[model samples]
Target: MTKDVIQTIKDRASVRAYKPKEVPEETLEKILEAAHLAPSAGNIQPWEFFVVKNQAKIEKLTEIAYGQEWMTQAPVVVVICTNPDLSAAKYGQRGEELYALQDTSAAIENMLLAAEGYDLGSCWVGAFDEQQVKEVLELPAELVPLAFVTIGYPEGDKEEVRPQKELDEVTTIIN
Candidate 1:
């Protein structure tokens, strides 16, 4: 049963390399909109994105990401962050930490799906130095970085999709 959404999801791959071409403004805007529309806890939607297209800035982020060179090649890197303070007024520190992180993750996924829909490649990068990234992006103190997404047109054929585990290997049926 092939469907547009399913096909997009299946086609999505974690692209580790990219061509040296800029993504158009309209396409970037649509991808950002997808991130904005993602659902959040209690509809609070605490995600904030820093769209970095400047080559120098991307290079710096790539350094901060500990030699993830592909980050620098991509046309744009969307840094998805969260403001815990937005959640703090209602819940405590735990709520601020957990919910804000969750909110940002959801937003990143939306952006990824949107990129896939546009036949663009994207990779959700979760490993990075929070403090260094904040310094690189000049983010506010209250905002916690969740993930960095590198997006652009594919440079070449994507690496093959890893084989999925069989249902018997991972799934369980509760009778």
Candidate 2:
């Protein structure tokens, strides 16, 4: 069997390098739509994506990400931020930390798959200074910076998928 959606899920990898070509606006719109359709806790959909295609904004984000210069080269940098006001009030502070991050992550994953399906490339960047990102994006005090996603055309052929440990190594059957 060659593979399918399940294989796509298993084969997905974080692509860091990208070609300098601009991604078409329509493709970006589809990726955003897929992200927006992601399921959320309490259907809050508290996530907001800042699609930064401007060179200046990309430069600012690159600086905020602490010299991750590759960020600026990508055609689009999507800053996934979460708004607390949209979240359920019952969960409290812990809710802010858990639900928002999880929801945004799911959205990001959906977007990455959408990109792959469209023959685009994307990477989820979570290692960054949150405060610097917030300041660069001019985010509201209530919005939390969760992750930065870089997307573009692949710079080179990704022929080899990373090796995976067999299921027996990590799974246990009980039923």
Give the per-residue lDDT of model 1 (tens digit) for 97-162: 788778878889889989989888999998889999988778899988889999998888988888
**Candidate 2: which pairs clash?**
none
lDDT of the structure predicted as candidate 2: 0.83
- RMSD to native for every prediction? 2.4, 2.8
Per-residue alpha-carbon lDDT of candidate 2 for residues 30-106, written as tens digits (9 for 90 to 100): 88998999988888888999999999988888887888987877989999988866664746775577787778788
lDDT of each: 0.88, 0.83
* Deviating ranges (above 4 Å) for candidate 1: 1-3, 167-170, 173-175
Pick the TM-score winner.
1
Please provide TM-scores, in order, for all candidate models, with all chains considered together: 0.91, 0.88
| Model 1 lDDT, residue 133, Cα | 91
Model 2 spans > 4 angstroms off:
1-4, 88-90
